[model samples]
Target: RTVYVNGAYLPETEATISIFDRGFLMADAVYEVTSVLDGKLIDFEGHAVRLQRSLDELEMAAPCTQEELLEIHRKLVELNDIDEGLVYLQVTRGSDGDRDFVFPSADTKPSLVLFTQNKPGLADNPAAKKGAKIISIEDIRWGRRDIKTVQLLYPSMGKMMAKKAGCDDAWMVEDGYVTEGTSNNAYFVKDGVIVTRPLSNDILHGITRKAVLRMAAEAQLKIEERLFTIEEAQAADEAFTTSASAFVMPVVEIDGVALGDGTPGPIASRLREIYLDESR
Candidate 1:
């Protein structure tokens, strides 16, 4: 596999960063993941725009222009022979050759890294058919989850928690309401109305969420942007989530309670179909 580090494309083993890199030392970085389908990038522009926003929120400068980023993504996809999968990109405050509490000067360049993960038939994941069972965990993450930074220790722990609970993934709850899935945005449907948390500093502004919701609305599915508690979601007729990787996936159960006969509901399934149909 080939990977990009700094400005050079090299073999995976050849790509390297300094141990003093701020992203590794202090988690001072932002990243984006764009899914690939049919040898093309899906929603690359949206990810790039969000990447810039995340960098801006942290007062960090972009490592390269959006056009350059796109070319890099294409090059890596081609070089890695990625027909179906995703691209991951990271930008971090570069090493200053010394560790200090203070940030380096603007002259210090930010480190940029890009790689491709090749997964065939990702859009046809069989798990989406059976739907998914998820457990709820406390949202212990920092306040600015809206920023797409690389501080993901808590989310990683949530995945482990889900694994231990015999579930596919975990939804994070704050103040009795679901914030999001550990790595994706959360949503549920009630009486044909789609309900999800509104965008704010509390939750990520999911790129797939934006696209799916728009498509749902255009499909004449009723939509609502408001907080819903775990109890409410458990009672919802249908539930699901959206992400660059997962697209739209059904949530059949929450906290040991099965939703609507524990089968993937029509709305969730339809949205997934619509998402896949349009995205590709």
Candidate 2:
């Protein structure tokens, strides 16, 4: 497989970054994942804009321009023969030959890397049909959830916790409210209305969430943006999640409680269909 590191494209095994890089040492980096369908990037512009926003919020320098980033994404997708899959991009403050708690000098350049995953049946993932079962976990990570940083240890652990509980994923709760899934934005449907937590530092502003909500509004589906507890979601008629990789995934059960006959709800199914149809 081909991967991009710094300015060079090379085999994945050949790609390298300094061990002292801040992204590795301090988790000081921003990243984005853009899905690919039919060899075309899905919402590339949206991901690029969000990437820039994350960099700006963290006061990190962009490794390259948006146009350059797009080119690299396309190039890697092409090189990797990605049809339906994902492109992962990361930019980090480069190593300054020494590790320190203080920020590196302004003259230090940033490192850029990108790669693609080939998922032939990404849009038709069978899990979407069966719907996902999720367990709830506490949100104990740092407060800057808004920034798309690589500090994902807690989320990784949360996913593991869910797996150990025989669940597909985990929803993070903070102060009795659902912030989001371990890696996606969370939502539920009640009496035909879609309820998802509003955008704030409490949750990562999902690119797919914005698109799904817009399409939902356009389709005249009832919508509401507010905090909903796990109990509320479990009581909901149906529930789902949105992310660049997963798109829209239905949630059938929460913490051992089934929602609506333990089946994927019609609204969630329809939204997933709409999302796939429109996105493709």
Per-residue lDDT of candidate 2, residues 183-245 (tens digit): 999999999899999999988989999999999999999999998899999999999999999
- What is residue 61's positional error in candidate 2, in angstroms? 0.7
TM-score of each: 0.99, 0.99
lDDT of each: 0.94, 0.93
User: Which residue pairs in candidate 2 have backbone atoms (N, alpha carbon, C) closer than 3 angstroms, thus clashing?
Assistant: none
Candidate 1 per-residue C-alpha lDDT over 1-280 given as tens digits, one digit per residue, 9 for 90 to 100? 9999988999999998999999999999999999999999999999999999999998898998999999999999999999899999999988789898799998899999999999998999999999999999999899999999999999999999998999999999999889999999999999999999999999999999999989998998899999989999998998999999999999999999999999999999999999988988
Stretches of candidate 1 off by over 4 Å are none
Q: What is the lDDT of candidate 1?
A: 0.94
Native-to-model Cα distance after best TM-score fit, residue 25 in candidate 1, in Å? 0.5
Show where candidate 2 strays beyond 4 Å: none
Relative to the unseen true structure, what is the C-alpha lDDT of residue 150 in candidate 1, on a scale of 0 to 100? 95
TM-score of 1: 0.99
